[model samples]
Target chain A: MRTIGLEDIDDIALGSSLLGSGGGGDPYMGRLEAIAAVKEHGPVTLLDVDEVPDDWTVAPICGVGAPSVSLEKGTNGIEYPKVRAMMERMLDTKLDAFLLSEAGGMNSMVPISAAARAGLPLVNADGMGRAFPGIQQDTFTLNGVSTNPFVIADEKGNCTVLYTIDNDWTERIGREITTASGGQVTTLASPMTGAKMKTSVVKGTVDYAQKLGRIIRTASDAQGEEPEAFFLRESGAMRFFKGKICDVLRETRDGFNFGKVTLEGIGEDKGREAVVEFQNENIYAEVDGEIVATVPDLICLVDSETFVPVTTENLKYGKRVLVVGLPCDPAWRTEGGLELAGPRWFGLDVDYVPIEELAARRTDA
Target chain B: MRTIGLEDIDDIALGSSLLGSGGGGDPYMGRLEAIAAVKEHGPVTLLDVDEVPDDWTVAPICGVGAPSVSLEKGTNGIEYPKVRAMMERMLDTKLDAFLLSEAGGMNSMVPISAAARAGLPLVNADGMGRAFPGIQQDTFTLNGVSTNPFVIADEKGNCTVLYTIDNDWTERIGREITTASGGQVTTLASPMTGAKMKTSVVKGTVDYAQKLGRIIRTASDAQGEEPEAFFLRESGAMRFFKGKICDVLRETRDGFNFGKVTLEGIGEDKGREAVVEFQNENIYAEVDGEIVATVPDLICLVDSETFVPVTTENLKYGKRVLVVGLPCDPAWRTEGGLELAGPRWFGLDVDYVPIEELAARRTDA
Candidate 1:
């Protein structure tokens, strides 16, 4: 187990945002909240999924809604713990540790605050190693873990407990409630036993995020190795392109930020263009009429200089960014996982081809 | 106390539809379900609010959503009981009786089915004497009763329990969930003690509805008494206008059937026109641009010949109908009630004037 102190907030936020795959919401506010929480309640203990006792119960907690709205509304900081408390009261069982629902974006940091406040340890693993729009698009769901009874708490302390038949219904109903509750809600769901967690969770993502954050932070131009190169080398990620954002189209539909971003290729890739489409999270990227990457793979964008991740809500015109692709957790490549998080699931006609395959095809061409 | 068997379904449906004020959804399906329930479980006992034991717990049960959708979707006959059972399990208290949430349209009959199935008594009173589009627009709300912890159940056996700060949040969040859960959900809320029920409920509405239904069913042209005249005399309602429908404009918005119907005056009122506007329930009626009625008062439309109530969903062209107005329950005229159910609350420019006062003004003019 590792302790997350105030000093670790920056690295965790930066790393999680990169892993957020351009969603999960901005981590700035989450970082601030975590700092305050750690200051007030001391450091939070982060436990590996395997370290948890067999009989222990772990619940995943995260914010669910439009990331843009979450930036404007902010959170009360009490929503997660309140939801956790309610769940415990309802179930008559103590939660052994708080699990991050996703190891990407602001959600990766949210659990730290909840853990600090509740004086509980946070599991180092997450349901999703990277972000996906719907709650059902997770390893736990693919592995047959139910998403209910789910608890959602809003800023006003109002709480809703949902018991649904399936994870899809959980997403449908939870989205509606979150939208109605002013477009942002903290949720605790998918409680699992330690044995189940060991198999279903994407393990070791918390420490990996912090390490990634450190890599981005320590990179120096004098060293001649770019932050992107370091990320690609360590994570087995592919550099899709380096480009300046030329245009962006975004709309809020069904409580999700959905749209596309167009980029004009820069440097070695000059004159070529690329487009990345997203629903809450960056889902797919096409480079000059060729599919470079698609979900269940990670399509991420980073600032050309600072290497800070550009979340979907922060995508802007005129900013130069490096597009990167990484393979998703092997669980996501399973038929059931692909059915839920694949391009076809998002209504795209193409079958999912891994990022490595696409890179090899590019090399051959 | 009274026993409501299969024989009572027709009268209850007829009377409740008249009280629905063009909303509440159609009572046909509810009546059929109630009949089937009573046939299988024997008759349901209806007890006066005062007859309930002072220490017993009472809860109102009803369906919430657009009336048009409820008709098309129909019910599986298990949602209400499921919600009630869930509520009992959550609260760890047995509900002594089931209370009707409203004494209008389909809602008036929903509790009967639940009560019959549960083998519990149905309270002969309701939160609303006439239907209002929102759950917060009720006597219980006006009298300081909270709507949480509200329970909603869908046909798929999925249930949601909401603990909101106030009744309005309950309506807002409940409506959102209902819309997402296929536009209709069974809800049991505003659980109260028997003593609170006596003061907060619109007492004797069940018998009143039955009596009004009998009046409508037994009326004959040979009697030389128009249905409107009989209705006005019995309920102290007023005949707003007599005309044949010329046009109907409808659109579903935010889970409600919102629109207006225009009527061309005929016979004694020839060359004149009238309009009835609705949002789920008819909220306003105007005769030749003069406001004849507005909520928190009742605006009803009936077939000119058969005297059958015309629900919002069934409003059609070329049907000769009589528009009627009745004063809302006196409790609804209170400051709190008006704030929730008044014309201004519905975005109308006018203040809430009692239907009797409007009738007097018309007579004076």
Candidate 2:
């Protein structure tokens, strides 16, 4: 177990946004909420998956719906604990800990606030190492965990308990309810025992996020090691390209922000172009007509100067950015994971080849 | 108290269809399902609202969403009972009886099947004497009954329990979920005690429906008392108009069959035109440019020859029909009721003048 104080929140938020891969919503509001909660309640205790007792119940808590809506409306900070209390009432048992649905952007900070306010420990692992659009894209779902007995709550104290047949129905019903509940809702779902959590979750993501954030915050040109090189080395990520965003096309569809961005090469590789497409998160990336990164892997764009991550809604024309690709947790490489989060599932007309394999092929060429 | 056997299903179905006011969906499938359930589970016991024990819990059971979709994806006779069971689990108490949300078409029959199958009594009363599109249109809503703790279930055995701040949110969330659950969902909401039921519900609607059906089936040209005349006299209804449908325009919007139908008067009323507009149920009727009938009253179109009710989906050009307007229950005349089910609520221009007043004006003329 470890402690996450107010001082650690900024680093965690920065790293979480980087892992958001241009989605999972912006972290500014969640960061403020978490800071306030921690200041008022106390530092949140973080328990690694292995530290939890086998019988303890851990639930993933996060927000679902359009990120833009959440930005405008903002949470009242009361919804998360209420969601946890509702879940406890439904299950007739106290929750042992709260887990992050994704180690990305606002979601990463939300559970911290919930845990701090509720006086419970926050689990160190997460369902997704990086953000994905749909609920069924989680590692727990790929590992055969049922996303049943889900609770959705709004700021008005209105709540809904949904029991669906599968993860897909959970997403469908959740999305509809979230949209109807004024575009966003806080949810607690994918309740699993500690044993299940240890097997299904991507471990140590919270610590990794904080570490990544600290590295980015301290690194400078005078330090001799560039922030991009440090991040790529530490996270085992591949540097895809360096370019200036030339164009961006975006539309809000079905409660999701869907868009594509074109990046014109700079400096060492002038005249070449790269394109990234996203639905809530970056799902596909291509450079000069060749697929470089796809879903089940993380594709992130960072501002060249500050190395701050650029979210999907923040991506605009004329911004200089560095694109990076990180290999996904091994669980996502399984057949079930591929079927759930692969290119075919997102309707991309290409097969999923691991980022490592693609990187190796480029090296050989 | 009364026992409703398979023999009574036909009459009940016929009367319920007339009460549907061109909505509530067609009763054919529900009638068939109820008949089979009754044959298998024995007759359904009917108790008047007054007969129910003061402490007993009674819930209004019905379906929400597009009637067209319900027709296409027929029920497997499993959803209603499951919804009741889910409610029982949530409340941690046994439900005493099932009440019809509306004494119209499919909903009227659905509760009978559910009660019979669950071995519970069916209350011979309903929230609405005739069908209304939205949940807030129910008399119970106007009588200060909260529509929280409602349950929505689907044929796939999926269920959602919603706790909303008010009836309006209930309708909004329920409708969205119903649409998402493949266009139709069975719901049980507005659970009330027998004392509340006696004051809030339209009592003895089952007996009234059966009596109306018997009269319509027996009366003919040979009997010298026309169906329309007998209906108006017995139900305190008005003979709105007699005409052949000249134009029927319909489009399904937000899980509701919404449109306008034009009828050309014949014989003594030749050259005069009547128009009826609807959203799920008939909301307005106008003849010769004057509003003759408006909700929260009942406006129905019946086949001139057989007196069989023509549902909104079945209404078409060249059908000879008689339009009748029935005075709504007194509960619906209250300010709260009108605000919820008035002409303005459906976006009509005119204010709601009670059907009795319109009929009285015609008599003075």
RMSD in angstroms between candidate 2 and the native structure over all alpha carbons: 1.7
lDDT of 2 by residue, A1-365 (tens): 99999999999999988888888888888899899999999999999888999999999999888887778877777688778877887888889999999977789988998999999999999988999999778998887888878899887777898988898998898888887888778999888899999999999989989987876676554267766677667656678888999999998777788899999998765799999999999999999988999998999998877777888988888999988887888887888888888888888999999998998898899
Candidate number with greatest DockQ: 1
Candidates in order have lDDT scores of 0.88, 0.86
Candidate 1: lDDT of A353? 94
Tens-digit per-residue lDDT, A1-365, candidate 1: 88999888899899899889999989988888888999999999989877899889988989999998988888896687679887887778999898988977689888999999999999999888899999898888988899888999999878999999899999999999999999888999988898888888899989989987887677534266665576567656589999999999999888899999999999998999999999999998999989999998999998877777899999999999989987898888889889999999888889999999989988998
Here the TM-score of candidate 2's chain B is 0.96
lDDT of 2 at A257: 85
Show the colliding residue pairs in model 2: none
Specify the poorest-scoring 10-residue window by lDDT in model 1 chain B: B219-228
DockQ of 2: 0.86
**Quality class of the docking in candidate 1, CAPRI style:** high
| Interface C-alpha RMSD, model 2 | 0.7
For each candidate in turn, the interface RMSD (Å) is 0.6, 0.7
Error of 1 at A212 (Å): 1.2
